[model samples]
Structure formats: structure tokens, C-alpha cells
Target: MTSRRLFLSTILAGLTVPALARAALSGAQQAAVDRVTDWMKGLKTLSATFVQIAPSGALTTGRLWIQRPGEMRMQYDPPANILLVTTDWRLVFYDGTTKQVNYIPVAQTPLGFLLARNPDFGDEVLIRDVEVTGGEIRITAFSKGNEDQGSVQLVFAEKPVELRRWTVFDPGGTKTVVTLSDVRTNQDIDQELFVWRDPQLFGYPDLD
Candidate 1:
């Protein structure tokens, strides 16, 4: 696949998963995941600037927004020509360069679980591995029923308890890492940000 395609796949991989390296979590590991999950569940809304590094070594920058109960938006920078939005179990990928949008079901992705009203790591979503090192906690997880799909690694900083980065491992075994900066949690993100409309209004081709 091309670099752009690989990168896009990685981004979408965030919500999808396959099999993972099975390991039981220790007391500390369980506590760490609990802490992170608590923080995430409490987040009413979040806005952040993100830097994404694709496995192919391609880099991209974007703005991100998330709300509870399955709502999210990723607006890529110019020349990237992509907008990813998820709402009500639907993930819409808009190709600004081509004026086409592809719709996906959020139920098929692990992300749907995270965006639920109560984000819990339960049957369908299982913890794979946990690592704590140098004030950082990394938790890896994969979807249970879809063990062959892929996995995601979420990195968090301790002490202040902040989410630092996330890495998505796609089915092709490509890792796409996204780092968050200038993060503002529980902010008043405008509802309109989640709306997906035709890009032609912004001077791109009409939606197909």
C-alpha cells in the first residue's frame, strides 16, 4: 500500500483490534489501567493538537476532538486531505482531495467501546499487556471476538496522570503512533465539529 493509505489505515486502526500478546495483569497493572480509564470516562470533551507518525515514516499533523458516547473528529492539516468523524456508531472518512466519503460501523472497532457512556474493559475488550517505566504507563488491548484484527497501545504519564500518546497496530502489522500536545480536557468543544458535510462547499469536488 502507499504511504498515505498505510497512514490512514493506522489511524482507523485506533478503534479496531485483532489478537494480542496474552498476559495477566498484576495488581499494579490493573490499578494503572483503572486510573487511566477513570480519567477517560470523566472526560466530558477534549481538544488537542496531534502529531501522527505512520509506520512508513510518514508524518502528519491534525486537530482532534472527542466527546462521550461515540463522537469524535480528526481534521488533518492541508495537503493531507482527510477528515475522520465518528458519531452514533458511524465512522465517516471524508477524502477532501477526492470528495468521497467512506462510512464504517463503529461497532466493528474497539474505539466504540472506549467512547461508550461507561468505558469499561470487559468481555469484548480485553487487556493484553501493561508496562510501567520511567513514570509512564502503557496498556495494550485487543477486541476479544475479533482476535485476528489488531491492537492498540495507550501511553500515559504518571504523577499528574496525563495521556501522552497512542499507537495503533493495524492488521498488516504497521504501527501508527499519535502523540497529543496542548491537550485541553473537559473543554466546551462545539457540537458542530462532529458534523460531516460535503467538502465541495469548501472548494473540493462534490461528494460521490
Candidate 2:
């Protein structure tokens, strides 16, 4: 797979699974899951700087903007020349180097959970594990019926429970880690950021 596709597949994290049983969770674990769910539901808009470690261990930096119930954008720094935008239930990926654009349904991506109007630990998403340590909470999960498609672990700070980072484990056992910094939540984000203008058609502009 191309690097961008790999990155996306890792993010998708096997949302195509047919059916699987939900893991049993203790009361505390259930509470933790609820907290994260509630937090995501309350999050309307967010902007952050992110550092992503690809499966090959290459590190890249980018800016991220998110508007819940269906919009997000990630723009990589120079040399990477990549942009990922999610809007209208579809993910549009633009490769500046190749001047190519590809679209995939948002429902196929793990991000669908975060973009959902009301995210819950329901049958579509199963909590594989949960851990609390060193003032952080980590929740690991995967789509039902497909343990082989890999899992995603979201790390959050305690106390107020803020999202810090997330790690995606691909089917081949490779992992991608994305850490967020300077995160601002419930802030106004320019709606244009989520707009996907095909660079191939419009001529490339400074996307940053």
C-alpha cells in the first residue's frame, strides 16, 4: 500500500468487521469508557498540532482541525505534501507530490466514532482493554469480529480527561502513533479548512 493509504488504513482500524462479542468490563472500566464517550460527545471543535510516527518509524508533524458530526482536516508539513480532509461522510486525501486525490467513506474509518453525533461504547465498537497509570487513561478497542484488523488505543490525561494521543495497530502488527499538542477544544475553526478542493483541478495553493 502507498504510505498515505497505509496511514489511512491504520486509522480506519477495521471498521468492516461483521460481528463479535463485546468484552466484559468492570464498573470502573465502564465508567472510564463512559467518560471518554461523554467527552467526545461534548467536543464540538478542536485544533491541534500533531506529531505522527508512521509504521516505518518516520516522524512527521502536522496541524489538525476537527468539527464534530462530520468534519476534519490534517495538513502535513513540507516534504510530506499530504492533506486529509473529512466532510460529508467521506474522507478526501490529497497528495501534493502526485497531485492525486482519493475519497473513502468515513464510515469505514475509526474516526467515524469521534465524528459521530453521539458516540457510545456500543456493538459496533468493542473495548478490548482499558488501563490507568501515571495520570493517564488508555483505552484500547477494535471493530467487532475482526481482531486481526488491529486496534486503536486512545490516551487521555486524567483529572479533566483531555485527549493526548492515539496509537493505531495495523493488521501486520505495525503501529502508528499520533500525539497532539497545543490542543484547543470547543474553539471556532474556519469552515473552509474542511473543504476539499482538488489540487489537481484548482492548481496547488499554500494549504497551510
Candidate 3:
């Protein structure tokens, strides 16, 4: 796979864990997880400008729009020529340069948990580690039986409990970090942003 495709699969496809034994959580860890879960459940909508550092150390900027229960759009800045959208049940990846489109189940992505109407961290996800430091909370997790696929570390600010960024580590140990800026939450986003129209058939429209 190309580096761009690799990064997308690592972030949105490889992290699915179908069935596995649950890991034990300490009292403090469980409390932290509860707080994170609550924050996720309350997040109805979000819009942000993001800076993504790929595994190759290449940097790209984009705008992100997300609505809960399963919808997201990531429109990369020009020269990157990539777009990713999550439909009701699938994650759609579009390669603007090649006009290629790919689809994968939404539940198979690490972001699925965040998009789930009721995010559950118990059986579907494994909490490998949790760190609280410098007024930040970081949760590192992966699929229980699918740890070889990769893991995602979600970073959040403490005082206000807002998501700031996430690092996705591929199987080879390379990591892609995406940091969010100018984040606005609980704001209305245009529903059209999440629509997945075939770029090849319908031609690409300005979804930005």
C-alpha cells in the first residue's frame, strides 16, 4: 500500500477487535475511563482545523467535521489530494489524484468508538494504558486480540476535558499524529459534508 493508504488504514481500519477477553482496570483507571466515556457521549458535533504528521514525517493540514453516532469528514489541503468520509456504516476514502474510492466498515475503525452513540470501552476495546500528566489525560488502547494491527493514543486537555489530538501507531511502530486546532464542539454541521458520492461517477463537488 502507498504511504497515504497505509496511514488511512492504520487510522481507520486496522484497529477493529471483534471479540476478546476484557482487561482489568484499576479503580483510578476505571474512573478516568468513565470520564472519557462521558465526554465522548456528550460530544454531538465537532469542527476543527487539523495538522497531520504522517508516519513519513510529512505534514498536511485539513478541516475536519464530525457528528456523533457515525459521521465524519476529513478534507485534506491541496497537494495532499485525499479525502475521507464516514457514512452511516462505512468509512469512505477518496483519492482525488487517482479518482479511486475505498470503503470499510465504520465499526472496524478506531474512531468507531468515538462515533458510537454509546461508546463502550469494556469488551470491544482494551485500555492498555492511561497517563495523567501536565494537565493532560492520555489514553492508549487497541483491539484486544488485534494488538498487532496498531494502537491509538487519545490525548485530551484536563480542565475542560476536550480532545486535542491522537497518535496512531502502525504495526511497524511508525506513528501518525493528528493535532486539532480551533476546535468547536456541539455546533451544527452541514449534513452534506458526510455524504459519500462517488467522485469517479458523479465528479467531485466542493464538499469543503
Candidate 4:
């Protein structure tokens, strides 16, 4: 059997098993994704904390704020003071010293779909699990073998359809956990909040 088929079957099979380590889904749960997606799609602003585990098992944490399908701001903690910002049309990187924001088109960024609610599930992501707990609905997506990507899990809440969290597991077993706590969903955020400017005007662009 080819590695691709083997990988695909493994994930699909897991979706039927009742293990946290494996994927699992229900008919009712399948419907849950639409609900969850709608909730995330409605959100105009969000805040979260993220913990990333690299391939070497080194862990890093950060605080993040995101607004709508476009804007986001993140500040990585300790040993890494990287502040990453983005808008619907561009990604901005803020370094400590020379403060010129690096920009990239949203269309060229894979994260665009990942951050958006109506994700293209057929291409790179497949719904594998859905569950509801307390007031939150959880949806898990495993990347199709062909996409050569990792698994991503998302959590949504009732009424207002607010998204609360997401988990990503890379093929190498590295993990990135994001929690959107103390979030305000559907808040009317100003468009100017997404715009970024050069930090050099302050003469201390890369201050730690």
C-alpha cells in the first residue's frame, strides 16, 4: 500500500473509533460543523492565548488578538519577542529593532482559510470529529494526505456562534494549542484597527 493511502485510511478509520487520540464523528456532529462555522464566521473580533510545541519539543506561548477574516495581532513570549500582525490583504511582522512591517498578500497565505470560518474542507481539511460540551461545540479536521498538512481542531459556542479555540497537530506530532478566552464576539471593530504602520517612527522599533 502507498503511504498516502495508508495515511488517509488511518485517519478515516480513526474517525470511527472512540478514542481521544483518534478521530471520531457522529451524524449529529456532522451537522455541528455548519453551526460552528457559522458562529466563527459571524465573529468580528477575538482574543486568545496560544502555545506552540515545535518539532524539537520546545514550547512557546503567546497572546493573540484577531478581528474578522483579516486582522490579527500576536506577541510571542520570552526568548522570542516576535509580534506578528496581519490584515485581510497583508501579513505584517514587527521585529524589535528595525520596525518596518513586512507584508504578504492574504491570498498567498495558507492561514487565510484556516483563520476563516468557511474553510475549504474538501481540499486540505476533512471533518473527523464533532462534540458538544457544556456550552461549546467542538469540531476536528484532519488534513487530507494530499494536502500534506496537519490536523486542526476548532471549538465554537452557543448563540452568537462564537469560536473559542483551535488545536493544530503537525504530521511530526508537534502541537499548537490556541485558546480564545475573555473573547468578545461580533463586536463592532473599527477597520482602522487592522491597519499597520511602521514602528520606526518611534525610533525604537525593536524594543524588547
Lowest summed lDDT across 10 adjacent residues in model 1 is found at 199-208
lDDT of 1 by residue, 76-142 (tens): 8877878888976798877766667778887665456657777777666778889989999888877
lDDT of 2 by residue, 90-125 (tens): 998877876777888876676777787777877677
TM-scores, in order shown? 0.88, 0.89, 0.89, 0.62
Q: What's the CA error at residue 31 for candidate 2, in Å? A: 1.1
lDDT of 4 by residue, 112-174 (tens): 554654554544455666777787887776544434445566677756567666665555544
Candidate 4 segments whose C-alpha is farther than 4 A from its true place: 1-25, 48-62, 77-79, 95-111, 114-124, 133-135, 142-147, 158-161, 190-192, 200-208
| Distance from true location, Cα of 188 in model 4, Å | 3.5
Clashing pairs in 3: none
**Candidate 2: stretches off by over 4 Å:** 15-21, 201-208
RMSD of 2: 2.4
lDDT (0 to 1) per candidate:
0.75, 0.78, 0.79, 0.54
User: Candidate 4 — which pairs collide?
Assistant: 15-23, 39-161, 96-205, 96-206, 97-206
Ranked candidates, highest TM-score first: 2, 3, 1, 4
Model 3 off-target regions past 4 Å? Answer: 1-4, 16-23, 200-208
lDDT winner:
3
| Per-residue lDDT of candidate 3, residues 119-142 (tens digit) | 878666777778878988888877
